[model samples]
Target: MINNKTIEKFREIETPFYYYDLDVLRSTLDVVKKESENSGYKVHYAVKANSNPRILKIISSYGFGADCVSWNEIAAAIKAGFSPSEIVFAGVGKTDKDIGAALKEDIFCFNCESLQEIEVIDQLASKQKKTARIALRINPYIEAHTHKYITTGIEESKFGINTWELEEVIKRLPSLKNIRLIGMHFHIGSQITRMSVFKSLCARINELQIWFSSRSIDLKIINVGGGFGIDYENPDKSPLFEDYFSLLNEFIDLLPGQTLHMEPGRSIIGQCGSLISRVLFIKNGSNTLFAIIDAGMTDLIRPALYQAHHKIENLTSAGNIYRYDVVGPVCESSDTFAKHIELPETRRGDIIAIRSAGAYGEAMASRYNLRDLPPSVFSDDL
Candidate 1:
């Protein structure tokens, strides 16, 4: 929630900036740390969610590991105080240069998504005279019931190794002496609200565990990639970390000496940040009132990209409520944020807050349309 004082602070700063409440982030991290620690589960903060240096530094301070998709993200995580040994690298299209860099860093493990990727990593490792630790990212073919663009783990998705290829991959592994298989990884999708989805993943993991055990494979890690959702409507409400951890403990059957790991991104950082903008003008559209905002898809692209919703609030007004189509200055018609949303009587220069933007908002920003990226503002600084 943007308090009266914070709104006043917003008036002093430039519009179209990201505002992060450090207290909210710390509180959310506290819950995650407590719940995961109680279950003896290792958590790797998904760096792609919000790789702001300050955000990364705060997360690393919690002693959690990092899950990175690129060598650049790994470098940022390391600069933010995350230990290289605690970082796990994952991506479907990892370039040769990135793989070589990760091999040199000797990071924790690579979540290998394809058979060819495994071979490449082995070759890279052989060239570097090092043994690369890897975990097979298996496609469980589970329905995440999320947006199609974000859903993975299906047979049609190019994100993970298909089940039919597992036999061949296993047969060829021994020949690649430079790599060692240590575990398995699965990420169904992002913004998954249903617990049933996770339960299904656990069941599949258990079945795969049995299959591996029969083959005398002693797996050491079970990494269920994170996709826990947050309440976008209610920005103050934190994610249900306790319930999520409890469900995993009840369902996933782990062998002795094995460890459970997760890579949470959105749930940890979504609620603590918001996009602060100002009403550029209040113009009449053909059928509705348009509250055009200074912030656009260039600053936060989730709405334009995924049709995602973020609660819009007029921070400076408390007059009679009216409906408006909140839009951005981007040239694209898809730059709309919310349509026919209720806000207090608004006008030009009124402060607006787009709630639940902390996770992918700033991280996915672009300089499209030749606009500058929005700067970040922390609560402590204000």
Candidate 2:
């Protein structure tokens, strides 16, 4: 929530900036830490969500590990105070250069998505005379019931190794002498709100565990990749960390010495930050009032890319509410944020707050159309 004082501060600053409430972030982290600690589960903050240096440093301060997708992200995590020993690298299209870099750093684990990737990591590890720890990212074929672009566990997805290929993967693991297989990883999708989806994933993991045990394979880690969603309508409501951890504990059957891990991204950071923009113009569309904002898809692309809904608020107005089509200055017609959304009577220069933007907002920003990237403003500084 943007208080009156914060809204006043926004007037002094430039338009189209990310406002991060550090207190909100710390409170969310406190819940995550408490829940994970109670269940003895390890949490690796998914670095791909929001790799802001300050965000990463704050999460690292909680003694949480990091889950990175690229060598660059891994480097950023390390630079932000995340220990290399607590970082797990994951990606479907990891190049040899990245594999070599991760091997050199000796990161905690490589969430290998395919046999080819595992072979490449093995070769890279062999070249460096090092043993790379790996976890097979198996496709459980579970539907997370989220947006298609974010769903990954289905057979058609190009992410994890399919169930049909597991025999070959396990058969070939013996020949990859430079790599050690220590775990299994799964990421069904992002923005998953249904707890049943996680329950289904746990059932599949248990089945796979039995299969591995039948072959006398002793896996040491079970990483259920994160996709927990947040309440976009209620920005102040925290994520269901306690319920999520409790659900995992009840359903997943872990062997002795095996550790449970999660890679939460959105649920940890989504509510703490918002996209703050200034109303540049109040134009009338054919059928609706257009509150054109200075921020564009380049600043926060989730709405344009996924048609995601974010609660919009007019921070400076206290007049009677009216419906408006909140839009951006981007040339693309698809750059709309919310359509026919209710807001206080708005005018030019009114501050706008796009709630639930902390996850993929700044991290996915671009410089398209020659627009400069939006800057971040921490609440502490204000």
Candidate 3:
């Protein structure tokens, strides 16, 4: 729960900033560590979520590995105290520089997306006289039932290696001496709520494991990449970690000497943070009220892009209720945060908290329209 006294303190700070409940984050991390350890699963925290330095430091202290998508994220993970051996790099378009950096750092593994990427890593590793460890990211074509932009496992998506190409890929893998294929990686989508979808993924993985074993390939790691979702409506409830883990344990059959790994981003940190915006004006129309705020799409784009819903709260008002189309000062009409939102009679100086924004919210912030990005504030004993 958001501390009322902390909400009061927010009134003194300028609006359009991120407010993180560090206590909630610590508790969430505790549960994740305990549950994953109990199941003998290794967890790599996705760096694309909220890479705030303080937040990353806190997470690193809990001893979670990192899952990075870019060279900068690798650097950030290293700066946050995560050892290079604990980092896994995954992305479709890794640049030459990025590959060189990963090879230099000697990270754990590269989740290789395509045959061309595998060749490229092999070449890069050969140049540096290093053997690159890699995992083939396979496209299982599972429909994650999520937003189209975030889904990645379908045949049409340009994310992973297609099924038909696996045989030829393995044949070619023996020729590439600088790269060692270690495991398999799969990421169906982001913000997925259906546990059944993951069950299907596990079944597909089971079949793939048999196919690999037939080719004399024994995988050391099975990385079921993260797509765990959070309850955007109820931020207080813990994420469905138990059901998520149990589904994998029940369905995913592991070979001897193989290890299970999971990359969880949103499920771990999405609900622990909120976007704090201050109302600048309250314009009244014939039947609606427009609560114009200082924050816009540049600060939090999920509401505008994905039409995502977040619980909105006015921390100061208690009068009669009214419907408001909460908007920001951006020039585009589609830059709205919420429409037909119900709140108490709000004033010009009230602070509104957009809840459940710790994942994509801060990670996707931009400097469009020349607007400065909002700073982050944490609830801690400072």
Better of 1 and 3 by lDDT: 1
- Model 2 agreement with the true structure over 1-382: per-residue lDDT tens digits: 6788988889999989999999999999999998888899999999999999999999999999999999999999999999999899989999999989988898999999989999989888999999999999999999999999999999799999988899999999999999899999999999999999999999999999999999999999999998998988898898988889999999999999999999999999999899999999999889999999999999999999999999888889999989899999989999999999889999999989998899999999999999999999999999
Judged by lDDT against the true structure, how good is candidate 3? 0.92
Off by over 4 Å in 2: none
| Residue 131 miss distance in model 1 (angstroms) | 0.1
Tens digit per residue, CA lDDT, model 1, 133-249: 999999999999888888988878988888888889989999999999999999999999999999999999999999889988888999999899998989999999988999999
Q: Pick the candidate with the highest lDDT.
A: 1
**Candidate 2 global CA lDDT score:** 0.94
TM accuracy, model 1? 0.99
Lowest lDDT sum, 10 consecutive residues, model 3, at 1-10
Looking at candidate 1, the ten consecutive residues that score lowest on lDDT are 146-155
lDDT, each prediction: 0.95, 0.94, 0.92
